[model samples]
Target: MSYVITQTCCNDASCVAVCPVNCIHPSPDEPEFATAEMLHIDPKTCIDCGACADACPVEAILPDDKLDPSQMRFAEINAAWYEDHPAPEGWKPLVPTPAPPRDRGTLRVAIVGAGPAACYAAQELLERSEVEVEMFDRLPTPFGLVRAGVAPDHPGTKAVTESFEWSFRREEFALHLATEVGRDITHAELLEHHHAVIYATGASSDRRLGVAGEDLPGSHAATEFVAWYNGHPDYADRTFDLSGERAVIVGNGNVALDVARILTMDVDELARTDIADHALTALRKSNIREVVLLGRRGPAQAAYSNPEFLALGDLTGVDVVVDDADLELDPVSARAVEEDAATALRVRLASEYAGRPVRPGHRRIVFRYLAAPSELLGDDHVTGVR
Candidate 1:
C-alpha cells in the first residue's frame, strides 16, 4: 500500500528531499509550493518505500493500511492531488555540484545564528572532505524558530531538530552559544578565522499594520504573542490583556490563526504542552470567548495554509465561524478559484465551515473577510475595533 499525507502535515517539505521516486507534489522548487496547502504524495508513483514517512518531521505520512478511521479520508485526498497534477513528466539526469579546488585546502567556515539554515548549511559544508565549521549564536539555545517560534502543541514539527544533531557530533564542527557576535567577536575576527560567514538569524520583528491606535498599550504584534507563548527568554516576562470577551486580529495569515487557536484552546490541553507558565496562566484566566480574524480579501484569498485551517476546526470546544457572505467571490476571483486547485480547496473548506452550525457555549473564532482595520478604537487601551 502507498503512504498518505495527513492533516498534520506542516508543509516543511522535509519528506520531499528524501522521496526516492520524487512523488511528492510541490517540492520547494515548484510554482505550486507558495500557495500549496500541504504537500501531497502521488500514490500511483509511490514505491511504498517509507522513506518519506521516515523523514517527515510531523509523522504526517502513513501507509494506507495503517491509517485509522479519522485519517482514512486522506488516502483519497492524496490520490485526488495526482488527478490534477499528474506524475512528473520525466526524470532528469542528476547534475553534481563541482567540488572546491584542492588548493583551497581544509575549508573553514563561520555561521552566525544557529537556526535551521545555519545547521543545514553546516551539514552541507561538513559533508565535504576537508571542510570545518564553527557556528555561533547570540542566544544560548539553538534551532531558532523550531524552539521559540513553533507552537508548543505541535511538538512533531519541532522534532525536525533531530536531523541537526549530526552537525554537532561531527569532529570538524564547533558550536558557540550565548555568544553575541558584535560584542563578543567582530566581523574581521570571523573573517580571520574562517573562509566564509553565513548569517542565518531569522526575522525577529513583526510588520506593523500602520493604523492610528496601533501604538496603544493593548495592541501587540503577532510575533510577540507567539514568542511569549513559546517561552522565548526575550518574551517570557511579557503579558496580554485577556479580560475582554472578544479579541480582534488584523490579518488572516497563519500567525493570526495560531494566535486565535492559542487564545481559544482548552487551557488544560495547552498545559500538556511546553507553553510558558505566564502565558498559560493568563489563558486560564482569559475571558476571551471570541477571536475575530480580519482579512482585507475574500475567503478565496485568505492567507492561511489548508492544514492549519483544517486543524482549527478539529479543536475541541472551539467553533470555526465563517459567514456565508465572505464565501461569494467576484467574477475574477471565482475564475481563479475554478482554475487553481489550491485556491479552490481553500474556498471549499471555508464554505464547509460557513454551513456548519456554531455550537452553543463553544468558544468561537470568527472569520471576517473583505474587512481591514482602519483604526484601533480607544484613547488609552483598546476598547473596540473599527
Candidate 2:
C-alpha cells in the first residue's frame, strides 16, 4: 500500500521536498541526509498522496501495484527501517515552498571533465536562460566513468548516462572533444574566454598499498585493472599478470569488488556487454581462479555496499566466500550495520559461507577482514603475495 524508493533513488532527495505529509525521515534538514546510502519512504506514516512519486525526476518512486520485479526487495527494505523505531502519530509531510526565480546574469561557464558531477552541475545551471555551458574532456568520448568505471555487466547503471546525453543534445550545450586542460590549454587561458571554469576532474589517482614490492611487475592497483578491462583509451594497451592461480586485492571498497568481479566473471558473459575489445581478449587469457579481498577491519566495518556484494554472488561461475572470524560486529558498528539495509545484505552473505576449501576451476572471491598487509613478498616479479 506504500510507495517504495528503489535503487534508482540515487540519494537525490528530490521527492522529500514535495511530499505534503513529511513522512520521509532524514529529510535534507536531518543530520543523516548527507551519508545515508539512499533515501527511504516511511511506510507507516505515508498517506499515499503520490506527491513524492511525482516529484522524483528519475522515476524511482514506485507504488505497490507498479513495483518493478527487480525492485520489489525495496518494499521490504523501506518497511524494515521502522521495525524497531515506531513513527509518531499526526506527523505531517513537509511540503517545500517554491524558490524565487534566479537572476542568472549573462555568464559563460566552461566545465572540464564530463563525468557524473560535471553533467549534474550542467543540468542545474541550464535551468537558467542566461547561462551557457561548454564541457571539455581529453577523450573523444563523453560520460567518463559511465563508459569506463562501471562494470561491463551493469547495463542498467550505465543506462543512467542517457539522461546526460539527452541534455547535451536537446539543450544549447557545446562539447569539445580531445581537448584536455593543462595539456592542450591552460586554466588561465580558459578563464579569459569564460567567466567561470569549474574542474570536475574526479579522483584519478589510486591509493598505493605502501608495502615493499608494490611496484613489482605482477602487482597492480585496482584503478588500473578496472580501466584496462573497461577499455579506457589510456589503458587499452596495458596488461596484467593473471598467470598465477590466485590474486590478492588490498582494499574492500566498491572498486575492489569491481576488480574482483571483472577478474572472476566469464569472458563470454562480459562480451555480451559493451566491454572494450582489447581488454576482453586479455581477460579471456586470464588464469586466475581466486581473489582474496583483504580489509583492515571486521565485516561490519567493511566499506563495500550491500548490493555490490550481493550482485557478486550472482555472477556466472564464481563462488563468494566470507570468513566467519571477520563477521563479528563490534557494538557500535553492529548497531549501524543492523540498521542499514545494504549492510544487512552483506551480513547475510557473510553468514552463508561455512568452513570449506573453495573448489578448483571455479573462480573464488574471499572476504578477509581485520588483518593488515604486513608485506607484498616477491622478487623479480610477484611470485606469491603473503
Candidate 3:
C-alpha cells in the first residue's frame, strides 16, 4: 500500500521535490501546479519509501496502513487520480540533506508571531546547533490559525499543529506569551538581544465590506466569526445575531465557507471538537437555515480550492445548491478550465451540484454567482440583504 495526502496539504509542492519515484501529480513544472489545491500520489508508482511524508511541511501525508480512521478516505482519493494510467518501473531514491557544521557562533533570532509560518521558521533554525529562537505572541498561545481560524469540525487539518510542538520543546527555543512588540516590548530592545527579527504577524484585521449599514448589529466580518468560534480571547466576548433564518456571505472564499459551515453544522458534531463553549451554546440556539454565498464572478472563477468545494458536498444534513444560470461560463472561463486542472475540478463539481436535486435538508447553502453586495438593507439591525 502507498501513502496518501490528506486535507492538510497546502499545495506547497515540497513533497514533489523530494519524491524519488515522481509519483506526485501537478508538479511545479505543470501549468496546474498553481491552480491545484493538493498533490496526489499514484498508488502504483509510489514505492512506500515515505520520502513524501517526511518532506510535507504540514504532515499531511500518511502511510495507507497507518492512516487514522478519519483519514482512510484519502487513500482512495489519491489512487483515483492515476487510475487510467498504470505505474512505471525504475524509480529513483531521494537523498536527505545533511545538517551544516556547528562552527558558527550562537545566533539569536526573534519572531513576532507564533503562526504556522513562524513555527516553521523556528523549526528550521532549531535544526542548527548554535541557533536560539524566541517566539512571541500577544494572545498568550501559540499555533495561530491552527488554534483560532480552522473550523472546529476539521480535527484532521488541525492536527498539523502537533508538528510545531516539536519545535516548542527544543532547548534552543523560548516562547514569550502575552507579549506585544509595540506594547510590552520595544523594537530596539529586541534588536539589542537578537541578531534578526522576523514578523510573521498574520492578517489580524478583516477586510471591510465598505458599504452602508456595515456597522449594523447583525452584520460582521467573517474573520471575527471564525476567531470567535475558535475561542480567540479577543473575540470571546463578541456575539453574532443568529436569530435570522437567512444569512448572506459576500465572498466565495474558504473563510466564507468556514463561517457558513459553522453556522449550519450540527451542534452535536461541533461538540466533539474544540469549539468555544459560548460559541457552541450560541450555535445550538441559532435559527439560521439558509446561507447564500454571493460571488462577483461565475462559478469558474470561485476563489476557494477544489477540496473546500468538495467538502461542502460531503457535509451531512446540508443541501448544496448552485444555480444553473450562475454556472454558464464565458469564453475566457471555458478556456481556463481547459488549461487549468484546478479550475476544471471546481467547475466540474459545481456543475454536478447544479444538477443535484434539492432534497429537504435541515440547512442549505446556495452559491449565487455574478452578484455583489451594493448595500446592507436594514434599519436598526440587519432585516435583510439586498
Candidate 4:
C-alpha cells in the first residue's frame, strides 16, 4: 500500500525536505503551502520508502492499508490533490555537497546547547576539514528538545536525533554535557579557546500566565510539567498534585495538548514509553478525569497546527469536546482564515470536532474558546480557575 499523510501531520515541512521523489504537495516553496490543511502524498509518485513517516514528529503518516477507518479518506485526499497540482518540471532531489577543504590551520567553534539548532550548526561546521566544534549543554543528555520537549509516545519525531548524532561521530566534534556557561565557564573564557561562540540555549523558561493566585501551590507552568515528565535533572524530583478531578490548562497550543494527553493516557501505555518513573507513578494515582483547554480567541485563532488539533479525536479513551459556540467565527477571523491556509485548516478541524458525537471514554478534554482566566481560584492553592 502507498503511504499517506494523515491528519496529525504538524505541517513542520520536515517530510517535504526529505522526500527523494518530491511527491509531497504544498512544499514550503509553493504559494498554497501556507494555507494547506495537511500535506498530501501523491500515491502514484510515492516510492513507499516510509521516509516521510520517519520524519513526521507526531507519527501522523501511515501506509494506505494500515490507516484507521476514519483516516482512509486521507488516501483519496492525497491522490486528489495531485490531480490539479502536477509535479513541477525539472525538479530534482536534494543532495548535500561535500564540504570543501580548508587550507587554513585548525579553527575552533563553541556551540551552546546540544539541541537541534546547535547540532545543525555543528553539522555544517564539521562538514569542512580543519574545523572543530564543541557543543555545551547544562543537562547531561544531548538533543535537548528531542529528549525533553517531544512527547514520549511520538518516537518517530524523536528519530531526528539519529542524524544529529552523526555529527558527534566526527573526530573534530566534542560534546560537553552538564556544563554551565556562566558558572563553569564564562563567555570571555570561551572566546579565549574558540574563535566564536554560538548560543542555542533553547527557551529555558515559560512565559508567565500573569493571573492572580498564579503563585498558589497547585498552579504550575506547563514547562515545569513537561520537564518533570521528560526527566530533566533540575525538575526530576518535582511532583504534581493530580488530586483534583478537573485540570485546567491556560493555553491552546501544541504543548498544552501534549500535557493534556499525557494526563489522560492509559498508564500502562505510558509505561511502555520513556516517561520519567516519578511522573509515571504519580500519573497512575492521578484522579484528574477532565482537562479543560482554555483559548482566548475563537477556533480560527487557535495557535495549534491542524494535525495536533485533529489528533485529539483519535486518542484511544479520550472524548474530545468543543463547544459549538466557541467555533462560531467572527467576520474578522473568517476573513483571516480565508486569507491564511494554516488558520483555515485549524478552523476546519475545530468545526468538525465540535459537531462530533460524544463517545464513551474514561477521560474528557474540553476545549473552551473566548474564555480568559482572570484569576486562579483558591487561597492557599489553585482549586479552580476563573
Best by lDDT: 1
Model 2: residues >4 Å from true position, as ranges? 1-9, 14-27, 44-73, 84-104, 331-346, 354-361
Candidate 3 lDDT (Cα, whole model)?
A: 0.84
Assess each prediction's global lDDT (C-alpha) against the native.
Answer: 0.87, 0.77, 0.84, 0.84
Any runs in candidate 3 off by more than 4 Å, and if so which? 12-20, 25-35, 49-59, 62-104
Q: Please list the Cα RMSD from the true structure of every candidate, rounded to 1 decimal place.
A: 1.9, 3.5, 3.3, 3.3
Off by over 4 Å in 1: 8-14, 68-73, 89-94
lDDT of 2 by residue, 1-386 (tens): 88887765566676877776777756777776786656777887788999987776567688977876656667876776566435545556564455435575567899999987888888777765677799999999888987889877777667657667656974568989899998999999999989999999799997777888888888887778788878898888888877787888888988888888888888898889888888788789998898898889777667886556655766668888877766778898788776765566557657766354466667899888887787777778887666
Number of the predicted model whose TM-score against the real structure is largest = 1
Local accuracy of candidate 1 as per-residue lDDT tens digits, 1-386:
79999877877787887887888987877888886778899988888999989888678899999988767767877787787788786544334568777786898999999988788899888877789999999998998988888888888778778888878999999999999889999999999988899989977877888888999988999888999999889989888999989999998988898899999999999999988898988899999999999999888888997667867888899999999988878998899887876677789889999999999999999999999999888989988889
Writing each residue's lDDT as its tens digit, candidate 4 over 204-225 gives: 8778878899899998999899
- Each prediction's TM-score versus the true structure: 0.94, 0.85, 0.88, 0.87
lDDT of 4: 0.84
lDDT of 3 at 342: 55
Model 3: per-residue Cα lDDT over 236-274, one tens digit each = 999888888999999999988888898888889989989
lDDT of 2 at 235: 87
**If both were scored by lDDT, which would come out higher, candidate 2 or candidate 3?**
3
Residue 172 miss distance in model 1 (angstroms):
1.3
* Colliding pairs, model 1: none
Error of model 1, residue 277, in angstroms: 1.5
